[model samples]
Target: MVDGESEAADIVEHYELDYDESGRITRGYQQLELVRTREIVGRHLPPGPLQVLDVGGGTGAHARWLAEAGHQVLLVDLVPRHVQAARALAEEGLSVRAELGDARQLDIADESFDAVLLLGPLYHLTDRGDRVRALREAGRVAKPGCLVFAAAISRFASLFDGLARGFLFDPAFRSIVERDLAEGQHRNPDRHPGWFTTAYLHHPDELMSEAAEARLRTVEIVGVEGLCAWLPQLAEQWEDPERREVILESIRAVESEACLRALSPHLLLIARRPG
Candidate 1:
């Protein structure tokens, strides 16, 4: 754990974080996440022979694609298990490598990478100082004009999820949701913390402000899986190409709409290190 954050590495290992990448892709909403993230990241990344650093990139899901596309990628995460899994990709001859590392104190050289990703680190860091330090480190390692992509769980995500899944009926869980809505902190105190570990949710504006505080120029912040993806029927239609495309088109159309973005479960902030 960092100075103010929880023992996030132990939690990640206990929860087996490696399943998220593969498991999420099976759900329709997560399918939207996969599609949109790749689309947005692809649009901004420079082509070919570039060094990309995936800070807190779990299990090398994004690293694999980036490497396959001819970029050299190095993924660092706190969980040793995730590092091992990511290293398996490197063993298979992809231009990728993974190692155990912390986002708050990166050992890599400054201005060393063409792009840096803080996709999972911010969500777990509850303290403001820790989050800022992580972002600044990302900015420090990135080339002056390069992009940094950071992801955050929306403040009201769990509230909406609880309502959708009927978890609100339980008094204990309802209280938890209320606390989450009030403070944006999600803590699992029980011995069995379930699938989700300790995390800090973020308001859309708050996430952008954090990036600016790190001196990273804000490019754009958009919802990964928009409100429409929450519909119950979306999963059923995933197998139908026409229906899936229509659903994806709808999500992409409103991804940047300010009012609608807060309804998304996850938000992405794309910023650049100032030249």
Candidate 2:
């Protein structure tokens, strides 16, 4: 493994955050992210029973769904616990192969997968070069013309999150937010697990640039949660189906609006490897 990846793996192992990733997306704004991500990605997916690779697919949340949808999926994660949890899904009859691997250096063959999902690696790889390497690896493993869906935390995410949750009141969190805004570098040096770990948030244009650097054709970059990420009544609104549809519709309206992409907490970049 590369030094950057080894350090990232060490941080992940020390923090023990991957264990909760499975259930994390089922609540609050994360639930919205999950729903929108599935909807957006699902719309672009080709016919099923295709070979798929889920790089850094934590706990197999998406992998399990894809396997159930009739795709042959191999989920590779840096965290051992995540791999174990994903492997357990197969015991429940989901057709998934879970393995421990680094995103920068996948053990798979070239042009192997019909689809490549780098849902969690880019953010964790704080170095720009490391991030590009991971993206290039995805491109190398993806068949010509196959889609690669990469997710990134927005550069303004810490600021928005702080203002929304009133975390800005805390001096430490405010400092974190300031650094995130200035440099896109996030570091929870105090070991505050809720504050998140080391990461590099991305500007919308920067994400597209990285894809280009990896030789992938940019299709589109859209906001996952749009402007509803910090709604005061998100939990309550999500409980009502009608309210939920209204929220989803609003997001779809502006998801592709380049002017407002940075306002969203998470951004999904859809690109294709050059055929």
Candidate 3:
């Protein structure tokens, strides 16, 4: 592993990401993110057989589906456990390859892939320069004019989550929420390590600016779940197909509505490197 990759691995190992991300999209509010991301990504993928680089694609969650759709996928991640899990998915015949690597310094040649997905790296990188380095690498490996899908936790997510869980009132938890609102940085204290590790959430404008800094043209920065992503009650909608469909449609309908973008727990940015 490269230096950056090693540093990332050491930091992320504390989170036990493989276990947390397991079946991530199959249940709860996370499903909202998965469904919307799939819709946006599938809509922009180039026609015919395509090559995709899934940088920081933990445990092959998205890569498996891309390969199942007949696209060729190579998934790289900082965590070794995630790499192992991803390789297991590949062994099961998903047309994918998995390996340990850093997104800031990809091992591929320039313009090598038809598309790239930096789904989980940006938030973890924390520093602006580190995040920009990862984005530039993704842009470098992507074929000119092709899609690059990037995902980030929304800047206001912690506040919304605290509100939904009814924990923002406690003095200790209130400090954490205040820090997240005041600065996009998120750090869980020793008492609340399960809340999250070191992370940098992004405002939608910051995401757009980062894409621009990487020499990528912004296609759109979509709200992954629109206005209700943090509501604790929405998890119940998953049990009823009709309620689920309505909830799904509700989020999708406001994906580009601007006013509701910041309310989502996550945001998906569709961008392209200049041709």
Candidate 4:
């Protein structure tokens, strides 16, 4: 309904989020999120020739990974450009299909896939009702078993994140912060044609509460990156081997604590349809 996915949507779309040259998607707080997600969905299922609906999955990163690993993957995004980009990646024969679609209205049959991944949509949708609708749609297309979602937390974590990693921000983000503080919530200027995406910070409780409404039971909730995201400068410094490994262990250790979870840059939750 709204243009672009939301603020969160723009963040993912605008950035190059794939694993770096080192072959990892995240570190520190996010380690647990990725670890737990892969563990639950990875171990529980039979070899994934399984059907997977990767909603709001930009650029088919996860879709390509899963598809190449032997699952049938469908990656959808709201932006036409995203679809084209993913399609280009799929041309290499990864058993992945990319389509342009909205998360609030998924054109999928009931119980169609073994898993549904809503990792991006929740961040952009600030309204509780709208987010719940997206969750309901995710539940609609998924069979009763495993589904996972990810969201970015609210700015309250900004204090920790700003301190831990140093929140060197994009010039675009300043306006967003001003609008959010003043108007309760606001969108940044349009980034591209018909694409009005920006960040929408979230309360962790809101995420859990919304999932509850959709009848999706919470399994595991973790952050994508805790203090590490704040330290983009340090992250760049980790180009060497020793520093990277040290960081890997250091961040992985704290990924589970309640305090660390609260301040994570992106929050990831793995939920399932109740039996």
Candidate 5:
């Protein structure tokens, strides 16, 4: 295992006090992330029935949908519980395959998948070298010219989250936010599961740089939640269909705006391996 990997896993295991991987993206502002990510990734994906490798795909959230959409999906995750949950989905008849694996060192054959996803790996791979190694593995597994969708937490995410939910009132959270803004390293030493886990939030430029270093050509880096990430009434708004559409449209309008990308909680980097 790489440095910090065990700590990250321990933190995530602790985070189960708040919610598990299955229910995480199904509610609140996180729903926006799930919705927008599916929309954006679906938009870029080639015609279906393709082979997809979902690296660090916790509990097969994306893999379940991709499989239902007719693509063959193989999901790899470090957490055994998550892998078991994903396998449970397969037992229910979805065609997703789940296995325990590391992102920096995939056990699969090279150039085997039509598309690759590194949605959760980058968030936990706090080391720059490890993150780049994960990206390079994504490239190595993807067919030439195929798209790779990588997700990252924005550097400003903790600050915005703290402010939005009054987490900043606590000095501990304030210190965590400070470090996140100053160095992009987020460490939660407290026992509060809501404080999240060890993560390396990324500046937009840093994500682009890492992808470039991995020899992946940048197609675009778009904000997943955009300006709607921290809205106080976002949950209420999401319940109303029309309001949700307006919110999604508003986000899409500025999803790619460089100045506003950092305002988002999560960013998705769309890159392609050179043919």
Candidate 6:
């Protein structure tokens, strides 16, 4: 757990620490697992060969898919279980590699890859500075013009979750809520000792600001199943390919609509590092 970051200990304890059937790859994280594998990969890669790094993308969902698509993928995560599981999966003929690490730091050299996928770190880092640090780490390893897609939760959604879950008034939780409201950005994801994990609710502008702070340029801000995260049965309702496409289109349809995009539950921003 990082000292300056909140929820580090709580989150680490809550995660499957060793990847023994925690179900994120197949259970609760199911929605994001698919949304990311499909939408995220396409957003970063060109038709030809490209190098990609999946930062905190557990289970190698995006990495494995991209590898099979003939691209080079390196899956990096702090959780050892996630990395081991991803590596085991990669062994079955996917051009994917897994490494255990913190999202705010990379073992590789600077400008080592074409694109970086930061789908998990943004939602978990409590401090804005920590978030910036993670973004900077990504930028450090990616080449100029490199594509980077990062995920963030909507601000209102955080309060909704807190109040709805009865943690809105807790002392630790209140601190984060007040911070985000004041900053017009990220709220707290602080958690109790265990039983659950901390997750931030965010704003599009806050994410954009962080990207700019890290010297990254925004390209596309894609919302992956934002409205549907609360709608448990929606993804299951997509019975056929046509219906699935329709559902996905509807979710993506409001991608740029200001009024709609702001409140979307989850936001995936396609950003680039300037040369």
Each candidate's TM vs. the true structure?
Answer: 0.93, 0.95, 0.93, 0.75, 0.95, 0.81
How far residue 75's Cα lies from its native spot in candidate 1, in Å, is 0.3
Per-residue CA lDDT of model 4 for 1-275, tens digit only, reads 24544544554455434212122344543344454445434654556688998887766657766786789888888766667777876679788888878788888888898888886777667666777888989988888776755555554544444345333154444455555544325454555322134545665666788888988898766665556656656546466667766755666677657666666666766778865
Candidate 4 lDDT trough over 10 residues, lowest sum:
16-25
Candidate 5 segments exceeding 4 Å error: 1-5, 8-12, 15-19
Q: How much is 105 displaced in model 3, in angstroms?
A: 0.7
Give lDDT per model, in order: 0.83, 0.89, 0.83, 0.64, 0.89, 0.71
Instruction: Give the alpha carbon lDDT tens digit for every residue of 1-275 in model 1.
Output: 24443466544655474344545553544677777788889888887678999998878878888898899999999877778888988788999989888899999999999999888899888888789999999999999999999999999887887777676787767777787899988865553333255788999899988998999999999998887656777677876899888877887898899888879888999999999
User: Global lDDT for candidate 4?
Assistant: 0.64
**Global Cα lDDT for candidate 5:** 0.89
Q: Considering TM-score, which of the candidate structures 1 and 2 is the better prediction for this target?
A: 2
Candidate 5 local lDDT, 50-150, one digit each (tens): 99999999877799889989999999988877888899887878889999888999999989999999999898888899999999999999999999999
Better of 5 and 6 by TM-score: 5
For 120-192, candidate 3 gives per-residue lDDT tens digits of 9998877788888899999999988888999999999888888877778777777887888888888775536
- Per-residue lDDT over 30-82 for candidate 2, one digit per residue giving the tens place of the 0 to 100 score: 68988998898889899878899999998888887788889989999988878
> Which runs in model 1 stand beyond 4 Å of their true positions?
1-6, 17-22, 26-29, 191-195
Task: For candidate 1, report its TM-score.
Answer: 0.93
